[model samples]
Target: MRLRLRQFRLRTGPHEHRVVQPGQPLRHTSLRAPEPIGTLLGDHDGLNRLAGLFSFAAYSRHTIVHVPLRDSVPPDEGVGELVDLVLAHHTLGLRPSRWPALRRNLVGGTPLTVRTDEARTDRDSTSWRERHERTDGRGDLRHATHARTFFLFGNRDVFASAAMSLALAAGWGPRQKGVVKGHSAFMTALPTLVQPPGGGHPLELLVCFKPYPPYAHFRRPGRRGERRSAPS
Candidate 1:
């Protein structure tokens, strides 16, 4: 599918999240894993704005993106182009895996519900330590919101996660928002390290979309394209 790319500025709130820069390696927070790089894109009253929420939730001044409606295209071709877009923009260090499952989800119309708030709740639970050690050990967990659940990517699966998020934003079907306090695999894996040309936001890219429900929250606000601060 053909896509239109646009550039915009976005700012982060006060949180200790990493930002992507040009010619730098993808750095981890410690020996464990890297913090998720949050990105948001949508349109408001005929004006499209791509903003960053950082670690928490804030919109100030930096750089982000907004993918306007994508051209109608077949699923396989669309996925291929998006994968190329992501890889062309950043070096993800992808492994040899064919990403069969990721392609399946995109082509077969699998429903994905990301509970972005689950990590926090899991951290505060009394049995947190036991659960962390027993499971992925990263405090990132996924459970079915209903019966029609599918696989969720974590454990440094940045390439697949990034592709999935881009596909969802660009018209991949059956995307919905749920709550999970745990860390976000997709957000953490988002490609946000490159510096835009001509001196602008630290990281910026052009994406394409078809008005999916996942980003509907950004379409209308108290004011059009108003600057919003990160949440405390």
Candidate 2:
């Protein structure tokens, strides 16, 4: 099995849990387990994203056993120790083993229901009521909406194969979004795969870098020695 590790900053909403609201935009940072098992099957990136999003920081730090399944058992379960290490480093007070619930819910065959609410006040449930009363029913009323439901797969290969199959069955068009960025190793391997004797798969990877906006402007010289407007 081959492994791929990655990191990303995910943008989320203010009401979203699992994020620390420090007077800034909500973002999630994570370190995923190596995807050796996922690489063979093909949906490495998809699977990694799924795990990163659902795998809460608290539980994974404790219960995740990194040893190969074939290895002999250690005298003492090290999950608790691993959890402690994570807490000490990140200062996030979360139990490491609590993640099995999330994993089970995702991997289980049954359909799962995810709930979200716009106005939730745990400390004072009447906060919303008071606000609504003060505004005389003209205040912004937010309702809980059901977002997309993701059918969980055990590994990356299955996810990729399913996606490719779906894309082939459903004709590609404007609604379909292509890959934006890929790891350097994956980018290098792509050229060889696209060489002669290989059919070019109807797929594309669009790499978009953030554009730097002009902070200041200056009058510079042109090639013809004329004054030109430039950004500094």
Candidate 3:
């Protein structure tokens, strides 16, 4: 199941040049440049193939695979093919005996498929206007339904909470080792990797958010006024 996957370190922005020359004056600015967040290891060729299979604009970058993190309303035609590709090349951290059930659930809309196309509807229609006019606690109907899916090793909620705690640590640098909390389940339906792909480091935490922007920052609102919390 182990494979040679490309490892990419996720950073918030472009690398800053700190070296100053002899005659150059020290330029000071309030703008904080991007910093490395974590590492992501994935199959380069497989990711390209997966992107080609989908009709939507899909690409892989530092922290995210630019594809829909969930299945769409009408269902994407390439979901089966994408799942097959993933199962063939990557390990879902499931045991040999659990493949059947896991495979079944995955194909049955398990939130793992990388579907990206948004549900199509008449943009200028009356129903669309009515639907968007309503508001939820976070925002109006225009607001996207935001949720997080945590990939954990043992007890789901416990590890999820632990992962969130670590993510909230703004001071965690690239060299800092992250911890995966909770006792091992031995073998279960949950996906838990002992080591991440290329780095072979202990897989501590991975959080997937549906309908996220291509970039890492989440402080700003969407074009349509949808608000998402900024990562600390």
> If scored against the real structure, what TM-score would every candidate get?
0.21, 0.15, 0.20
Give lDDT tens digits, candidate 3, residues 1-232. 1111222232224531111011211111001101111111112222222222221211111111122222322211111111111111111132334333333322212122333221221121223234433522111101011121112122212222222222222212211222112111111111233332377333322221112222243322223655545646
Off by over 4 Å in 1: 1-41, 44-93, 96-106, 109-112, 118-203, 206-232
Cα miss at 8, model 1 (Å)?
32
What lDDT does the true structure give each of the candidates?
0.24, 0.21, 0.22
Model 1: which ten-residue window has the lowest total lDDT?
Answer: 24-33
Total clashing pairs for each candidate: 17, 6, 2
Which of 1 and 3 is the better model by lDDT? 1
Off by more than 4 A, model 2: 1-30, 33-109, 118-232
> Candidate 3, TM-score vs. the true structure?
0.20
Cα error, candidate 2, residue 18 (Å): 18
lDDT score for residue 20 of model 1: 23
Candidate 2 structure quality by residue, lDDT tens digits, 1-232: 1222222122224321132111111111111111110111112232222222222221222222111111112112111111101111122232334323322332212222222121221212233334544654332211111111111211222222222322222222211232112111121100011112345442221111111122122122122654534635
* lDDT of model 2 at position 165: 29
- Worst lDDT 10-window in candidate 3: 25-34
Task: State which candidate has the highest lDDT.
Answer: 1
Over the stretch 187-225, how does candidate 1's per-residue lDDT look in tens digits?
222333333248643432333322322333332224466
